[model samples]
Target chain A: MQGVEQGVLDLDEDVNRYLDDSEVTVPETYEEPVTLRHLGTHTAGFESAIDPDVVADWDAIVPLETVLVDQMPPRVRPPGELVGYSNYGAALAGHIVAEAHDTTFEEYVQSEIFEPLNMTHSTFAQPVPDDSPGNIAAGHTRDGDGFQTVDTVYINMRPAGSMTATARDLAAFMRVHLGAGTVDNRRVLQTDTVRVMHDQHHVRHPAVTNWRYGFHEYGHPDAGVLGHSGATVHFSSHLVLVPASDVGIFVNYNSNSSEHPPPGTVIDEILAVCGLQSSSTEPTPTAQPGSRERAETVAGGYSLSSLPQSGPLQVIDVLEHVSVEPAAQNRLRTVTLAGNTRQWVETDPYVYHEVDGNDVLAFEVRDGEVERMYMASEPTGVYQPVPAHERQLVTGSILGVSLAGFGLSLAGWGRQCARQTWKQYRTETDSVTEGEHTE
Target chain B: MTDHSESIHSQQSGHPAEHIESDERTRSLTWLARVAGVTLSTVSLGFVLLLLVVIESGGELTLITRPFLMQVVLTLPYLIGFLTVGTTAGAVLAWWHRYWSRRVRIHHTLLAVLGLGFSWQLVRLGFITL
Candidate 1:
């Protein structure tokens, strides 16, 4: 905490420290440079390796610095390479905070962040206080017999998972981010710094797609959504915010039933109730059960021999080359030869099942037999399909860049009138750039 | 002869009525006991299953061991509730079936309670070992 307060442990400094000591040994001096930002954002490439003995009491155990130092190794990746989810990185950051403040990690967080935010109900401890108000929902699992308690897990990883807080308290934490780093007039982080944290820092591996800083970046940069999800042995929780819409959501569940709604359900439902349209209007097909007419209509076999053998095929292949077997009323077992996966196709007529971003296929019966297909031109990639509007925007951006380059060359003639004319043309052509500058 | 014959008939009729009432009470108690037992067993089982799912569904598995498990056992009251309700129902049923058999009722009640308590404790401990 002191290092961060003293501005001695900046993001780049921490990254450099990790990179320098990544292969061999970490110097003692490098330890003080780690901070909460590095851990929370996973900028520090700390290894996940942990000692078995210490992990035994993971939930309640508070390991001394010596134990942690002896057990875990330095970061695996180079500093600032990309955000790869690292719990050990967060642990090291916690250690740095503890050392800097001359107090425990729990104490520093309690005094610095928790108390200031008025998150009185939150605690970084095991065995929540008996007198704590609000219901501590009992965690349960659904087995063949029924729901049972799970009694395993250590408390030693408290910095990473020992947090216990009410929904309201979590909401308050969200409010801090939503309010631009200030909660109840107390600034936990600078507004610009919080914005930086929310910005896309690194793209996680396997595919250079999802941006990872401390966690997965939610929603597009323009869409203004940010959050993280935390799952424990018997519970799952999420905290999210849509800053542009001035909205925030928090959800926690103790049951392991897939029947329970997904994490974003509450937020989506709330947005729907408010009659707000999502920034992204891409249609998503949801699977439902027990609808007769639609199921019978879409139930049939489909084939697509027109598709190219390899590389990227046209959207037509995705739409036409599919088969559906009626499972129940309203539900049809969809078979796509391309992906080779069985998907539950919904029966909603207006809402077409999305085979890909632009392509929406409907399984309908034309005559006596069930075989009808619909296709649309669309782009395909591992990442979410770029919207048509976004594609147009990209094109416009490229055009604007070309135009700006031309104007810059024209202005190099060193004529005052020519420069003014070029500036006006540039401003007119790229209003977006000018608007961003004004903001 | 008339007095002896009348007394014999009355004894035969009363014996069947007593048997029917005892049978009805035993059936009622047994049904109650079964409901309680299944409810408790299902809940405990569910708790364990939920933990597994949480761990499998991207939860940190290392968090569910030892001191943490012990803390959950102590703080969470659901396990205790399940055992108490299940055992009490079993005890009441045993009493109903063996109304005259005090020893049998006590033995069954104790056994049911002990079995449930032991199972709960064992599951709690097993999570750590596993």
Candidate 2:
């Protein structure tokens, strides 16, 4: 086990080594040791290509580290760069695990993490077992007639979003964290380490004010919740624990709802099922105002004529358009939209800018509405509420990278075998010719 | 003594030529067989990779929203790679068989066509969002 841990760390180091030399710049070394906590929490400032989903075969195509090293460059944001979720951070953690054990990230997770956790149903490889107890839910989007399956994405970005575990097993793993890192008398993390894992790493997003090391922090600091939410094609899973209340809730839904349903829905439901509702008297507002407001501005739906008609038009699809987000004090922030999320400046009289040729369009509200709504020949568009199916596609792409990598590796091995055979035949033929000459 | 010398020289010379021609033919046939085998193997490997990709993708095609036509356009390179390699192997085998083997079977040609057909199917299935 110790050896495995070392291997995990080695992989992590390998990732860092690549990052250091790549265009993505980071400090040579941090004054403080960068722990798994930082990587899981998105404190590490690493950016990834938004289109990692288009890659069909990850392993046969490219290794995760190579892709990251070649494609990504570290552009550190202010310690808390909004609530910009970092897939790179999780990948770094996977790298750490690999480096520690002087082995591959996949092998380390299989031995140390998966084996001990008994997450037998889970794998980092794609095309998960067909005969597994439950069907691996297919991600679908309603086309004209019925739901059509979509291409899942591969994020050579491992560790962050490379895992594939069933809800039952993941819940059990969560229980260990709830138990402060000890499961079945086996300690996966020390109590203090677990606390560090749950400690708030960033407070950039008002929606999620506190982000613990690897999990999103919810509620007030004293009374809020702790845990991480995993989103992938048509599947959304959340595990929240109110350490104060000794309450833990694990929710997994197969539907593709883009609206991040109220954080406590599953937890609240579980509490009700258990006949315990501490805040039952407080009426639950079926309509959450914040999400509704954001939905109104961004979710009314708009079509981009310039976009290719094949897939859904994502925020990144409009890289040329200016995007603004509501920040503190009734002001909007100038943001660069990548996907559903944005990283913006939170200053007064907010300005939204998008790179147009060499110039930038700075958009602001002159009246009470978005000024110059339709700027260029590019049509003015609003956020179309993503159907449940589309949401699943987005989620699946995020989760599919690991599985894709595993599949690609098989193809690579096949090619290697063919080459080896050819080499052997050539060597044997040369030796035989030499013997004939001698005879 | 002269009769013995003449007999020995003629026998040795005739045997060497026959053996050289026979060995050349055998080598050619073996090369052809190897080429055919390798081509088939490559095609098989490609199909397997496709299955694995689909499976690993959780069998979802919706995630990749590019139109079927566009997908084909993008994946053209990979398909071409498979076809090029497979065809080269088949051609090599066919040449060997034609020169060295008694029976001029069109198996190599058929295998080449089959390999191309399989590649086409993969491209259609992978890129076309049907």
Model 1 C-alpha lDDT versus the unseen true structure: 0.51
Q: Candidate 2's residue-wise lDDT over A1-439, tens digit each? A: 2332323332123334433333333454434334343455554444332333434554434555565556454444433332335555565555545554556787766776677877787777654546655566555544556566654555455654456777777766777778887778766767766675666655532322356666665433334567666655455666777765666777765534343463356665665575444332321222323433432243222222222222222323333333344555322333333343332321112222222111111222334343322221121121222333233333344324423432454455578789999999999999999999999
Query: Tens digits of per-residue lDDT for model 2 on B1-130?
Result: 9989977987777667777987887777566554544545454554445544654444333234344544444454365445545555645655754543433234344445445544433333233222
Runs in model 2 deviating more than 4 A are: A1-38, A48-61, A73-82, A129-135, A143-155, A205-208, A219-222, A259-439, B1-130
Q: Candidate 1: which stretches are off by over 4 Å?
A: A1-8, A15-38, A43-60, A64-67, A70-75, A129-135, A143-146, A204-215, A220-222, A257-261, A265-439, B1-130
Judge candidate 2 at residue B71 and give its lDDT.
Answer: 47
Q: What's the DockQ for every one of the candidates?
A: 0.02, 0.04
DockQ, candidate 1, vs. native dimer: 0.02
TM-score of each: 0.46, 0.46
* lDDT digits (tens) for residues A315-384 of candidate 1: 2223334455666434445555445544343525422433322223443345644333432211011111
Worst 10 residues of 2 chain A by lDDT: A353-362
